[model samples]
Target: MDYFATVLISSLSSASILLIATLGLAVVFGLMGVINLAHGEFIMMGAYSALTATQLGIPFILAIPVAVLVTMVFGALVEIIIIRRLYGRLFDTMLATWGLSLALYQGAVLIFGSVSPGIGMPQINFNVGDYTLAAYPIFMILVAAVMLAGIYALLTRTVYGMKARAAIQVPDMARAIGIDSARTNTLTFAIGCGLAGFAGAILLPIVPATPSMGFAFVIKAFLTVVIAGPVTLAGSALAAIGVGTGASVVASFMTSVAGDLFFFILTVVLLRLYPLGVSAKWRIKL
Candidate 1:
């Protein structure tokens, strides 16, 4: 019973973290079909934002908005200067963003050195029989759940979402209806990057802020988005849970790195079966 409970908690924790990390990437890819390889840099920025905020003596809770705003503005600028021109050119966008990712990584190293301090995990724990579970993961679960619900509400109920959806699905029609497709696209990209930053803030304690830390997250998030099918929020959630659980179960019996490899193999096999991905037929307003 104790082992089962531990596994369950571990799965939930992993799933929640993955969900938050991938949400932004999923949005950007799903709506625009633009592969922003530099997406992980936004997450790295968020981690740094949180670290800076902590150094300034600000509470960790307030660092989230700081991270979001910082990344959002940078993302907006990237969209206006680079991404906007490469809208229809998928391969070009990927290559351009890949270069941008390298630049960001080196820039971070120059500015902050190779390693920076990591935030301390909150010092609360819950006893589950013979097992003592950290409260931080439970907090992460709540944060992910709330973020998901909030995103659903924003995409489903807001005017911006309506315009963004219209712009993506039918740009000519949207423009004909007086919707500024260009502006909508810019805002959507910023929002996606902002969410990525927020996820980084949430993960600051678990993973230290580092220039290259973003790559670890990018791989998992990319795999999740691919499995979820670009543009399907529901599918993203389901994929996160399924993948996190599979990885967690394997990690219990093997090394964490081995578990990651196992999950990667599983994802490849599954993709071959569902070529269109888990949510190929689904579309959301975002």
Candidate 2:
């Protein structure tokens, strides 16, 4: 029972982290239609940012916003400087973002040094009995919750979201009706990157920060989006939870990298069976 409880708690934490990180991918991919392979770089930036804040002697709570804000700005700037040009070329965006990821990762190594930088956890341990939970991570979970709620409200209740939905469903029609997809896409991408950054900062203690950490996260998040259909937020979240928990279980049974490969292959098989991105007959709004 103790071992079972440990697994359960660990799974929840892993799922929560992955869910927050991947949520942005669903939104960005849905609106932009560009995979933005460098999505992981945002995570890397967040981790490094948080690490830097600690190195500068900033309080952890204050450092959270610093990580989110810097990454959001970086996300938007990358959109304007690098991503904006890749519009309408899905394959090209993939290749371009791949190159961008490589460069950004190396840049991070240069700026922060090749050694993995560890962010110190705050003193409080957020725990429920024997499970050792950290307060900062709980803060991260709350952020994800708030973000999920805010996004749902925005997409379902607000005018900007309605316009975003419009641009998504019928870009030509939205444009024909005078909607500027370029503006909306930029906003969506920035938000997505900010969300990923939040996850990174929150995950600093759990996984620590390395130049290559983002790649592991991006692979998981993108796979979740692909399997769940980037267009459906609910589907994406569910897939993240499923993948996270499933990977934890597999890793407990075997090796960690093997667990990832196992989940990847499982997702591929499941996707082929469902096709249309795990949405069954539900189609993209566009």
In TM-score terms, which candidate is top? 1
- Candidate 2 structure lDDT: 0.78
Relative to the true structure, candidate 1 reaches a TM of: 0.96
Q: Model 2, range 141-250, lDDT digits (tens) per residue? A: 56666777877788778888888778767778888888897787677778788877877887787778889898778988888888777456777767777877788777
Each candidate: how many clashes?
A: 1, 2
Q: TM-score of the candidate numbered 2?
A: 0.88
Give the worst 10-residue stretch by lDDT in candidate 2: 277-286
Deviating ranges (above 4 Å) for candidate 1: 282-286
Residues 191-230 of candidate 1 have per-residue lDDT tens digits of: 9999999988989988789999889889888888888875
Worst 10 residues of 1 by lDDT: 277-286
Clashing pairs in 1: 30-231
**Model 1: residue 66 alpha-carbon error in angstroms:** 0.6
